[model samples]
Target: MSKPVIDIAIGLLLHHGKVLVGWREAKQHQGNKYEFPGGKVESGESPEDACRREIYEEVGIGIKQWYAFDRIQHEYEDIIVYLHLFYAYVPDDLLTLIQQPWTWYHRDQLMQLNFPKANDTILQRLFWSHFIKIGDKLSEFQPHADSLFYWRVDAEQFQRDVLHTYSADDLTKLILNDEHYQQLSDDLKPLIKTLHLKQHQLMQFKKGDLELGKRYIAACHDLVALQHAEQIGCEAVFVSPIQPTQTHPHTKALGWTQLEEWSKQSQVLVFALGGLHPNDLAQAQLHGAYGIAGIRNF
Candidate 1:
């Protein structure tokens, strides 16, 4: 006989640099562990609806907006669980209502606490919140420590040169834009583990069509593109033109309000791109970006 599969909706509430977490009951299946607020998904209820209901029931607060983050499945001795994770911000006025067993902890403190084994992947993704550098020349840009690179040069000769210039560990950080990525030689392809998809390429993408074990990131402009990215299993999406750019000054920027709206609307991790610098990190986070992607100021 097989164990029943159960669905769970989990919510991670962020407010003033802290995330809400609760302790599981001692007698429960995964007891005595600290967990992001959530509960089982009931029959006939959607995961998003279940998440909202669970958070309200457990924390005494209502969440009107949330962005989907990631999902995972794990099997314990008794049952299999499919976990859907979402991220939302809690208002300052409601902070006082979050009480005992449900406490707010700084992001850094999350890893130190005990959580269910299935949470390992989500925890790691949160820990490595990113910054991405997008451009041609490596020497021309100085990115933050441990930042990822979106190498956009398309010349086949230049692409190979760049790939061979960095060590394997360093190459792993590179997400080659589609043109350069497609031009790689068979041997050189394994050096880079991520692929950056242009809007058109993303439209044609399907699971199993690309090499396995690599991460795919899509360039998304709006909700429709974002939904497509999510459906195709992109690990992240670059939503661009957050500000008018030097490259295209006449192109109207999305501005902060629209950026925040896109972040709320999409489940995939959102990277704010265009006319941004490292200094914009705090401002971008305030609007709910997973990271910032830029060319000159990376």
Candidate 2:
């Protein structure tokens, strides 16, 4: 039998002035060098647990707000290794007491450091810290023009036979957990076509439960919604009722005044998602959005 394979979990730690990296002294045929902080994952231990243990043992600090980021597999030489990379933001103060011989490179200081295959891309994305919800297959993170471009679709568009579906964060988790839709939300699936995303979503003015995040779409403010989108790493947020219509005609409309206001001071991308269409895009852009997004046009 091929020798029993070992799994590895890595923590990509970011602090005020440095990122957590570790040196590989373990004996393996593969070249040993500095790498992200991690150790071989025990069969029974969860990835998160492994990461925490490795960090605490190697550096003597705690990780907070840990979240699953990516799972990558690679063949360095003859052996196949699986890497589960987790993201945890660290406070700026922890950079002082680190024990290991770790290098503290400024964000783009990769030239002198050694990075594994998937580490570069992951690191770049994490640094930008902004991602747009494209259709189900992909989500654009980097900017297209003056603004970050994102393709968004509502829950109504998800079940349709369309090629791409955009979703919020929660809806994405649901799609991933589904046996059938597990691969449905694959971010790299649509590389050949375009960037897409599937977000479960939260709102204060869209048509869902107010307790969560959905609002009636009419009650939301343009600036507040834009900030929420940026905070969640979304490239753009949709603001509706620009023209006023039946779906939510009763809800107050922000009208041109709000649109003009958004154009002046908002930091995130805004899509006119209310009773609007392709022709109306010019109006939205004129007010200050990169472009207009709407279900009616599609």
Candidate 3:
């Protein structure tokens, strides 16, 4: 017989840039794992009511506002869980009311902790939406010419300077080579808005493997590369060398005509890269390009 699903309500309480998490006690179902504090819905109780009551019982705090985030179903060896997730804004002063051992973790730090297998799907969705929403909101006020910024840096430079200076609101995405992508710490991964991968790096993994719970864009120079990126469900693709570039001056440029032809064929958003300047944005868009990416032009 199939296992029955247990309906549970969970809340992610956010304060500042962190979310509240509690360490499960030894006697609990998923012992020693970190979880967003919540419990199963009682008979006749709504999910939101259960969530609020559970939080008060567990941590002695009352939350007035929460937005429904997602509903996830996961099957474990013994039971199937139907988790109803919600996101709420909590006051900093309410931290003193926590009765159990709890900590406020930044989005990046949550990846390093041990969570129940059932929570993985909801966790990924939460962080992905969090960063993307920030990016969308920031873009609304910025100039159209500054819509995107390409960050091309070595691993050392990224950690030493880029991490300290730039934030998700500061750039559209950070493009990294294979070596630099591999060198990033687990705690730093969630802070990335959209991570751009080189062609070879993207080829090493299947659709879901390269997903670090972030939006991904892949570099493409040919039809095969573009198709591969689309097959893997990349958010965007970068088609380069539209004009002579100082970095690769020896290679011939794919001029506007070819760039437009390729862009029209792309299943995913096409970013016109290589020798691009702010002045080229309008022209690139005229040819079906989503946006332009560059190294020094920004």
lDDT of each: 0.78, 0.50, 0.68
State every prediction's TM-score relative to the real structure. 0.59, 0.47, 0.49
State the TM-score for model 2. Answer: 0.47
After superposing candidate 2 on the true structure, give the runs of residues whose Cα lies further than 4 Å from its correct spot: 1-4, 16-18, 25-29, 118-121, 127-148, 151-200, 203-298
Give the candidate number with the greatest lDDT: 1
Q: Among these predicted structures, which one has the highest TM-score?
A: 1
lDDT of 1 by residue, 1-298 (tens): 9999999999988764467888888998799888888899999999999999998898888877766766788999999999988767677778787766788776668889899999986665555346888877766433345688777765643536555766765666677876677678887787777788888888888644654445678998777887787666566789889998999998888898998887776556678999999889899989978789998776
Q: Give the C-alpha miss distance for residue 160 in model 3, angstroms.
A: 5.5
How would the candidate models be sorted by lDDT, starting from the highest?
Answer: 1, 3, 2
Model 2, 1-298: lDDT tens digits are 4644558888877643246666666584343766777878877899889988887787777775564556767765456777777756565566576775876654445535666664654554433211222233323332332222333344444443332443442222111211122234455232212222223333322321221111111113446655443444332345656777666768877786687786455434455656666667677767865455444343
- The parts of candidate 1 lying over 4 Å away from their true place are 1-129, 140-144, 185-187, 207-211
Clashing pairs in 1: none
Candidate 3 residue pairs in backbone clash? none
Residue lDDT tens for model 3, 1-298: 9887799999877664467899887898889889998999999999989999988898789987665656778888888988987666666667788776768886657877899998876565434211111121222323223244445555545553335345554433444444555666675555555677788877775654554345567788877888777656565678888989988999889888988887666546677888887678789878867667665564
Better candidate number, 2 or 3, judged by TM-score: 3
Can you tell me which runs of candidate 3 are displaced by over 4 Å?
1-145, 156-179
